[model samples]
Target: MLGTATDAYQPVERRLGITRRIVEVLAETGHPFSVVTKSAGIERELDLIAPMAAQGLVSVYLSVTTLDNELARILEPRAAAPARRLRAIRALAEAGVPVGVSVSPIIPFINEPELERIVEAAVAAGASSAFSIPLRLPWEVNPLFQDWLQRHFPDRAERVMARLRDMRGGQDNDARFGTRMTGEGVWAELLRARLHRVARKHGLRTERRPVELALFQRPSKPSAQGSLF
Candidate 1:
């Protein structure tokens, strides 16, 4: 819940403890929530989360883009190693937590080839569900990713961009709600089909868990007098 667009437990969290406190608060309040992160440090918060999981109030999604460690380092220099994330998944699953593996930003040609293998690894590590989305390049991200591709993968950079454009309908991006995450076109449809096939083959779920609205209690705001009518 706390981590969606950005990582909740980045390296700074180890020193700051802000995300841990947020998880602790969520556990205390009995709010059903989910967290998505690319950090192994999330394991440090299992003490707060496992009990919440018992109430169906917590789920975790570990973002793993590629199985190749070298590629992972280049892709996310600050993120935890792939093996460590897998270990975290196993640990959370063993502790009675419902874990999901998020194979996000599935870069065409670069990491897309590992879709099935990544799902298999997640399932093997005890994940109960899996999900993925193809890579999208917005304004700034578009140029940056392009530069990176050119620098690192000169031979296939253009081809990769072409494939992405094919998915994005000859543009750098598709902002439509239904097609934004998965794109649109023949390649996009094929990518979605493959992801679904892999998830089904591995017995990983994509359904939403029922929300327990009864357990939600709005937190009280602090006041100068510490009391209010």
Candidate 2:
């Protein structure tokens, strides 16, 4: 409510709107569960954009950090905006707005080198929690990602695929419920190890910060005399 979101940022919010609709509809249908999904989109202009949470409105920014190869993955140039995003998150933090930084799509080979930098940037920006999701390709995303590798960096594309296959259990993706977010076997172990090492070194906890749960007050009823009349 304190900043202006430009045209480019609006469409990014629209992408998250799909999830918002699902949450609203599920609540209307007696789903009996409270769903709160946050922190994704074109994070370049995240500060300018704010979505209402249970309390007032706040902005949730997630950095995807997509890369071509495992090496490129580590050096994945800071996406869309380097300074504005940081400034916004810092400003919001000082304003007492809850903030979370997501180093998402932590794909197999590439997501290693920049891990510490990412965490440091987030901490410097006043992020309260750190979360990450591994790379996944349900349908065409796998092939599209592979081809993107071929087009951009043919030199090491084959090695990248090999490492991905190792983590993915000899496949491009493993869609099973338990293994979807994390790959399988030895390579997956290494990926997890590196992440843990970097996370600990930077003092970045994996859990999100706690929100206040004592703010609910029921709607007031009419006074007794008014009700009687």
Candidate 3:
């Protein structure tokens, strides 16, 4: 659907009202779509989404990096607090909208220890599924994140990079098709196993069903009528 490296509901969305209009159109067109957001601002548009969820045309996935307030602040300074994200998840689920949690860009030593806690918290907050990915530092992101890591976590920054390199086959990034998202080597394997175990323990969906393409339809373009010779 709509979610693919872009967040539909950003802070500016509150003012621009663009995403709201987009959601309304999706609802009217009966097109299934998903939104991934880091803010509770999405709550403002849930009224438009709830009815769509009844038709399985909408789903919301909130990204939470960590539950620790201190770490969360540093990790996502402008994002909604971890607690607020959970509340939004609960509210959406209460409204009969399918809700999911994404503990994305899971840093190795920083927030990896909180994996189980994060997933459990989402489950308690009514998430139907959960997923995560190891941090991938690419191009400029690599240097920027490294700088931040050094500034904030000087002691453990090198260790974190080392772990990432091991996962990436001795480099900062591994961009291969299958290995990029999950990475490789021991740590990556363990991470996958742990993810599966935790998801199973809480009865969350580990494998998502492919989107039903049949639900999508495009209005036919009108023909130039009466094109007489």
* Best candidate (score: TM-score): 1
Model 2: CA > 4 A from native: 1-61, 64-79, 109-111, 209-229
Task: Name the 10 consecutive residues with the lowest summed lDDT in model 3.
Answer: 220-229
**Overall lDDT per candidate, in order of appearance:** 0.87, 0.54, 0.85
**Candidate closer to the true structure by TM-score (higher is better), 2 or 3:** 3
Q: List clashing residue pairs in candidate 2.
A: 70-109, 70-110
Residue pairs with colliding backbones in model 3 are: none
Model 1 bad stretches (over 4 Å)? 218-229
RMSD of each: 2.1, 8.8, 3.4
- Which structure is stronger by lDDT: 1 or 2? 1
Q: In model 2, how many backbone clashes occur?
A: 2
Candidate 2 lDDT, tens digit per residue, 1-229? 1111222233455656654444333323323221112222333332332232334333344453432334433344323444445665576566555665666666544654565567677778786556666667669788888877788668878888887777777887888889887778886776667666766766765664443344433224534664775
Candidate 2 to native Cα RMSD, angstroms: 8.8
Which candidate ranks first by lDDT, i.e. highest? Answer: 1
Query: Which tens-of-lDDT digit does each residue in 1-229 have in candidate 1?
Result: 6677789987889999998888876776777888889988888988888888888888899998999999998899888899999999999999998999999989899999999899899999999898888898987899999999998889999999999999998998888888888788899888888888998888878764454556866556634563554
- Model 2: weakest 10-residue lDDT segment is 1-10
Give the CA lDDT, 0 to 100, for residue 140 in model 3.
88
lDDT of 3 by residue, 104-139 (tens): 888999999998899899999999888888999878
